[model samples]
Target: MRSLVLIGHGSHLNGESAGAVYRYAELIRERGLYDEVVEGYWKEEPSLRQVLKTTRSTDVTVIPMFISEGYFTETVIPRELGLGHQGPVPGEGIARVLGGRTVRYTLPYGVHPSMSEVILARAHEALPDLNPGDTALIVLGHGTTRNENSNRVIYQNADRLRESGHFAEVHALFLDEDPRVGTWPEVVRSPRVVVVPFFASEGWHTLETIPEDMGLTGEVTVFEDHPSGSQTVYYARPVGTHALVAEVVLHLAEEARGASERGGDEDRTHAEAWHAFMALAQEGVRLGEALITPHGSLYEIRHALDEGRPSDALTTVVTPEGLRDLTRQDEGGRHRPVHTFRNLPRGWRAVLSVTDLPQGVHNLYPAVVEEGYAHHCHSLRATPWPTTARRQTGIYAKVSRATPEQVEAVAKDVCSRCLKTRLWAGEKLPRTFFTRVPGAIPCPEACTYFIAEAREEVSGKRSQGGHDHG
Candidate 1:
């Protein structure tokens, strides 16, 4: 059976981010849809690269468990896995593979047809008394200045729902551009309208801004004197936790399977192999490290070549000629590096500690590892990484040798790096509950505690703009 990989845009700070993906992976695994199912994240452990190493199925299908078909779906995941539609070399269309490993990539979770069910479910929950001519539904999404495609998906969902004739009106509003959610009152003529968030998780904007801006109370409420004196506004929960999301993953997997099967006649270009080699090298680049000349790098290179992106190989090099010269110099290399990288394949497993908190890993963990994946007890656990680390109440990663306290420090370090990036960019998220003094040196010593506490505080402060996950 094929291995199914679920990739999430995880958070080092918010443990729930990873929890959601794992939950879905487990659910799917329980149904026996795939022989092997695993979870990986862009930010957290058992990363996309490493998670790939843990699976041994001849065929692999990757589903991007993101909320939208934006950057992470379009750029980041593809960049990481070396999959996309491109011809080989200058003349022929070649089938390129990743490090000689053949895998198919499906569209993200957000763009799947199954999402319509969640939207309809949210709308129904928002307006139970709805009958046709009375209540309207407004889907709100956090449109980005960076990617217009994000809003496009939201609008498309709106259109699909609108065409279904479920509500008197179904429209979409964005946080960034025109037809904004804050200005939604101007466009609506309905007496009562349900506002549903089109976000992945109940993060800052959905929990705070839209409701505050729309003059809502509780998760669902109505307001008068907002649009017209008769108009009532109700806010609904985010569409992330719905059961229909699984269908979305299946749909994406099918698409990837089709594409991979149809592209067999393509040429064999070493571009993918070259690209993978460069990616591995770049990981070590920050430490001023370089990859071994021939065999050590060949596996990733071959994978890339099979996937059909020779140009990526060319770009991975500091100089294209340098990479070409290296490949030519060692054209007769052996597969010892491949043997070193390949290991015993392991299925997805977790030992979660549950709690009452809604946002922490503790709550999300049980759900993520529920049905599809395996649960490991302390003694039978595959690695001690889950036990040794200083774990936040809701988070886990594979750090075998480290103590729990050491893992806690690593978590804090990830948060600190992200915080530094935010500061350097002079950027502000849509909903921020607390702000540090400008140029304040963040104390890294208590970083994990601060991150968990800061997010908890932010989630509780809905009036200030952060989402209330609780």
Candidate 2:
């Protein structure tokens, strides 16, 4: 039978993300709609790669457990699964994916019509003791300044909820971007506020962040003596995790099964990948360093290649041909590096890697396959380089965090990124990649980074940015 795989953005910080995905998957599986129903996650196990391998079904459907057709749905998922070279299409699409599987990729959850009832049901469940007319409703979302599309359904649904005339006021707030949730107290006119979190799960945002951001004393709490009066914010569970979402997943899967194919024949290019790249560019993710071959170096390297001479200054070149190609295209304008290295969403993602993230193995300096792709994680993980004194080449790194305590936090964040990326690149993630900094006192050439014992405080422009990335 055709298997169904539910993809979720699980949390490295909390297990609730995986729990919610499993809950939804179990609910769907109990119906026995498919031969197998398995779940996959980005941040936690069983990873998307592991799930793919575990499922022996030749025919399958992968539904993104996201609210909208945003970055995860568009870029990351497609890249990981090797489905859409172009990027995510709206709603659903049929793609001849890897492993020769006829995978039907579904749109995120929020677009389904059944979701409106799900949200309303959640509100009704949360407001058993209060009156809907006296209570204001807030659709809290994790909005993004990077991609405006992330919250389009949120505001649209908020308007729909307001039109229902069941609440005193209906407003939308986001944790990331404007309409900041903090400003709700000033505009909220009701004594009771029911917050239906528009998150994928009860991960960081729903359980920890939204509650902390709202300054609630408990999950369901009463804040006495606000300017508006004593207000009780009823923090409802995430709509995505609500049992009704199982139906939504089935709805999307059925839609995917019914729809005809809409992807291109093997070689067609797409603007969606570029759009996702540009969207990410606006999001302010800094690279620890870009392993960019400068125009002069690029030219020198090309000349060397022509003359059969190896680059002296270049330690580990990404590729011999792509560097030459980039150098050939430099026409005086700022030459953006085709790729970069960082401790990020995963490891070593290209600055514009619309194709993949948790990109390969982490590189000390940047190297690339130009507009093409190249990452070395699988080989690296399977047969790791021995960090021997013979290849000892140490270099210091400056972490952005202020204190050693914060330094450890940032270090662990980077470690999490490595593990996250490794899952995508190497197909299996180590439970823990590192504790403090990776490398030893006598570092090796293939070692990702080398920092001595005790993180020396980075007190420069790099330190200016907040440690939230950690």
Candidate 3:
């Protein structure tokens, strides 16, 4: 049997990226098509090197677990894995081949031929309570910054879906550029529309930003694009987890198997591999929010995630001074505290206006796995806060990637030692240092320092004598 290896751009904070890939791997293995079906990632565990070394299969098939085929498929994976050109043309493959294996790398699942059906299927599955006449189908994609080619994949499918007369109207929107969500309602003809994200994982954009802007209400937090109360918006899951994707991967594996059986000719295997890769590329699409890892710098992880190509979208949430100026004045006629502003230090404000929240049409993230997910504009804690937007907020953070032994030793120091007294320069401190400041950027630039500080504070105290330290 053939071997299948699926790789994802995973996240430590989001938990959904790896979870989606694991589910896909389990489905593929359950089919009994390959002698081995494995999962690997660009970030998190079961890394590229580890997965390859452990598989032990002389003949391997690698498929990028992504929603877009722009950079990761083109440059990053090949460069890092020593892969050459993917198809069957002579001298087209990468120069450095690893181990003693004859390998094949397939295109991303997004570009597979079977995706059209899958898209239609996903839409139908997400909106079971719908009539075609009243429903508008909007296909949302992570619009790219560096590559113009990324939007084409999503647009192609939206055009085809529209031509098929599947819904009241079919439109495509991107997260990166203009013709943004704020502008969507002006163009839509239908009174109600369902948006489906073409993303690989359920991360920040899908869970938070899109719904907040669109004014949607739902039950499951993971699937946040459904209509709120009488709100008409609807959302579907990312295309990666669709059932047809499994068939696409299996089909590519079968083609590769056929090439192998005919003869061990490198050209033939390469040719079949190339088609699969191309198909995968056509199906893939990406947006701006990226995966960051501690093993690499922000720039390095960005390169690893996008094949060293400059993104068409902004990499980080850089809230400029101009943007911060938009914060509303308090009822006391003050501009509010400077600490409430993000990105800036001390006291500054960024203010953005919700000028037009369209009624009939709504904005949504391109990739969502469920419908009826909900989020509220709440405070970071359950404690009530006096603000224009009032709702509870949850913080996301990564505590440790260090081994268990290292974590335990640090725990010991904090429990027993009165380490909170120790300061940056041996001065006294308050507990607020350990807690996050309200309205600040969730992750500081020096995230590593935060992790280190938390570990040291807890472990250092424990080592001394079970003191309730900060």
Candidate 4:
């Protein structure tokens, strides 16, 4: 069996940071090229450290959905995946034999030559009517002084566009380093310019910071009384969000798969756990915010609140990806990372085949089936609050100084907002009243958001020169 794992840098502040990664994973899964396709993140659940354990496939291909071959792609990800200290070299790729499986790591998609095509396509899509010869193209990247490779891809793409002679001028701009986005007016000579962000996902930087720095108000911003004369600017979405990028990932995965030897057997334990969960689902089980019930050969999954509603009454989602997208946001249109939040909207139901049931459940509530199976087997490794706090580093390291009372208070507050039962807190704290569901999902460890909140509480108390004894 073979698996494909896409890794990205998820954010605690913005759930959409990993949106593109999830979308690509689903797209690839629909193609049915691999036995399994999953996503791992640095700052989100089903994290990099534990993503491998969930996959039953023996031969796995890991791809980084990052914009550059820098710190994250080169250092952090490899270390987290136990691949070694250095990342895979571009084009050649790298492979390692670990834990009875052959894991192949590939160069990030951003460094691929195909990215230049994605950038050009984005530029043309943003301003189709405008003539490329009269419009200047700007590839905006979040460059850093720490990693020179981070800036290389941007320059390479700009040079490629220049060689193609599609645009009157191609300029590369950065958010942090020299030739910043603010200097766009002075850098470009064309009267019309299109700026395309070279980042992976549209999060804080693309949505807020880049627009603010570039004096852009909307898709088309016109400057009448500017220092460099009147010019019309068109802003394109991030290049990584383009649909064609999925094809690039597939190309990389195929190349790596051809080069590596696949021999290890499937993870029988994971298969057994999935089978056990399926057996429970056959008798109707409530997992997280979903109420899954078997209807003949198909499983009908709906919000736990809509248990009694007839199938015709609720909106039916035909595809698994459709249901995943439907629940990606809340009623207010904000991204909800905690999929098990009680507010799973209303009047939406999904009918999935027996084969697709596991993917459907995972899309709605990630990693729940595995956790449930582990809990049933008495093998769930629930990390306590103290151990979780001690694992923190950098600014979050101060979380260790928080009093037990403060930790308890924060856990109660945060867990109340989420539907997952806090298995991490162990027997020290009583279970939240709402999370007493018999087959509810389990949280094996404190999430990054919980750690952030704990750090804030500890910092606030220290600032006020007060401590809570209780």
How many clashing pairs per prediction, in order?
36, 2, 59, 0
Tell me each candidate's RMSD, in Å, in order: 20.3, 19.1, 23.1, 5.1
Each prediction's TM-score against the native?
Answer: 0.55, 0.54, 0.51, 0.81
Best by TM-score: 4
The segments of candidate 1 whose C-alpha lies over 4 angstroms from its true place after superposition are 84-96, 259-470
Q: Give the higher-lDDT candidate: 1 or 2.
A: 2
Candidate 2: tens digits of C-alpha lDDT, residues 361-384: 112112211111111112221212
lDDT measured at residue 75 in model 3 versus the true structure, 0 to 100: 60
What candidate 3 gets wrong by more than 4 Å, as runs, is 12-15, 85-98, 129-132, 219-231, 255-470
RMSD of 1: 20.3
Ranking by TM-score: 4, 1, 2, 3
How well does model 3 score by local distance difference test? 0.46
Better of 1 and 4 by TM-score: 4
lDDT of 2: 0.53
Where model 2 places Cα greater than 4 Å from the true spot, the runs are 11-16, 43-46, 97-99, 129-132, 219-230, 257-470
Residue-level lDDT of model 4, residues 301-350, one tens digit each, is 88888889887898898677778878877877766655665667777899
